[model samples]
Target: MKKPKPLRQEQILGELNQAPSLRVAELARRLAVSTETIRRDLDELTEQGLLNRTYGGAVRSLGTEPSVTERHTLFVSERERIARAAVPLVKDGRVLMIGSGSTTVHVARRIAVEMKNVTVLTHAFGVATVLAINPTIKVIMLPGDYHASEGATVGAHTVSFLQNFHADYAVLGASGLGQDGPADALIECAAVYQAMVSQAARTVVVADRSKHDRLFPARYAHWRDIDRVVTDAAVGSALAEPFRQFGVGQVLA
Candidate 1:
């Protein structure tokens, strides 16, 4: 059966999340729809501010982060490896605070499958959902205004709520990982991330290679604030220098 227009449009955005740009013909072929249908769907999604029309097909809207479902389609293998590397850092029966993002979702999956008797506090609906699969894990949802695009909660409410508890570790994902440290594309999320960093005994940043050297507006923490970074990218002098300088450990997956 053919998917409805709304579902089909969502599938289009998911494809764009895997690869930022899309071509109409390819989208039509993959979705089993006519080119004209794909074009119309793209046009409607663009008008709705979910995506931007390009010369050929579409792209993610400027300054807009893809939804968690869309982001799950991206960097699958690398994210899996990074998640596996991060799992060894998590001890059994510890309290963890995790931030929102696709990579963090991968980490949550690892915690579900490989660990037990752990408590997780998060504002991301996706993270909480994944952790729920593990019977031994305790999932705590934080209070805040929900951001649908990211599938997470953010705002002063979320940050304030984090103040009441401390965790053994705070696992976070970043939009950019530069020499200065980890940063988020959305300013609202940065505050929640900063709060988690301050309240945890240690902080780990999980990011893929694409985030390297990029600069985003909301700098969550300086290098000194992070305890370690887990990624799939090979660390060269440029990336290694900052970690070494700040005494932050880098784990390559």
Candidate 2:
């Protein structure tokens, strides 16, 4: 009555290749199957190296860290949804710290369009430029060695610059997330993120569902450092436990 497991796996891989991420819940909903079935398929596919499991979903394995340009095109809808959901965490006239990455870039765009009378401190040139267009938004660019591909600055200069000021809120994005906390593929970027969190009263993470259990080179923030997590979908206990341990509130988009 059902297609073979191999056939279903092939279909799943095909979908993943088209989109950067795939959620097990959505797959189960679409296929009229149980979440357990989808999870088993993902586990098998992950073993075969066709896909790697994420927080609440799976993504194709390219064997290398993706460039910022490459990342912008993937998961556009999810990132947009995350941006819209996380924007309210920012209020007018608040001093905000923004991080680099595709998701954070989208969040910057949303804040630029929707909110006013805010000051933004960021190492990302793109984010500074986007928010600078708003008359009510004051953008402060952090000094550092420029990373062209990342459209941001990193290293000691950026880290040193953050010490000069504090922010009401810091909105960040993560490349990977595990039980230990948020990790970044680039160690240098993680340093900047660490500084961002340190200087803010509240740190909010805007991420998609695709970062769960995924570890990267640099572990940046612990659960205690993150005040909130705004994502596209609800996360399971395995991923949510760390937030609970630290009293980090999870907001599903």
Candidate 3:
């Protein structure tokens, strides 16, 4: 009946996202854990640079990303539509490098039902699990340190492992989309995403309308690095012009 440390810490970070800060006593009561256990979790999270510890609790770290569970619940309909639009871009019997994110998971689900005889390389547990439902799809997981918040593997090992093979397409999700390009809140994830883009022939970025004009800590790809962008709405010229100038395809899903 106890939550795993990673899940617990993710929940704590989720709480901070809802509010500016959270007290240890409040979290203990809500999580059904002791104050000491909460403190230990807080200590570990702070050491990992995921949160800022206060006198008796923690605050959201600057530029901290929301947990995958948290992100999965927002823009549900938009993400599905984006996936539906993006999946058709894939042809059969090609290799894909899929990045980890809620939007990318939707893309994977669409791929599972619609495509066959394809090979997928991914660091995301959720993306791999979804694609496994299709017997025709071969899923290869990349090696790295597991990041619980994002439910993905990321580290130098993951980036290095990508050099072994090239992919036909690299499908990625963005924490924020700006003129600078699709960025990620986590540096480790950005590194993996950047490597994926380089190793693939073309790159497709999937993001909802909410991410437009937002900036994050790591800009994984520039406009020239992207082959296509699939989003829910038509952004203004500031964002759209760069895609045009770079000859990147824009899909308004």
Per-candidate clashes, comma-separated: 0, 1, 0
Which scores better on lDDT, 1 or 2? Answer: 1
* Between candidates 1 and 2, the TM-score winner: 2
The Cα error of candidate 1 at residue 38, in Å, is 17
Residue 161 in model 2: lDDT: 91
lDDT of 1 at 156: 91
| Candidate 3 lDDT tens digits, 143-216 | 99999999999999999999998999999998878897889998999999999999999999998876677668
Give lDDT per model, in order. 0.86, 0.83, 0.88
Off by over 4 Å in 2: 1-64
C-alpha RMSD of each candidate structure in angstroms: 5.5, 7.4, 7.5
Task: Assess candidate 2 and give its TM-score to the true structure.
Answer: 0.77
Where does candidate 3 stray beyond 4 Å? 1-62
**Per-residue lDDT tens digits of candidate 1, residues 1-253?**
7887766876786677568688999999999999999999888777655678989888776444556676676577789999999989866339999999999999999999999988999999989999999999999999999898889999999999999999999999998787788898889999999999999989999988766765678999999999989988766567689899899999999
For TM-score, the strongest prediction is 2
lDDT of 2 by residue, 1-253 (tens): 5667766765675577458798999888766678899899898767655478998889877433566775675567788899998998776438999999989989999999999888899988778877876899888998999988788999999999999999999999987777888888888899999999999999999888666556677888888889889987777677778888899898888
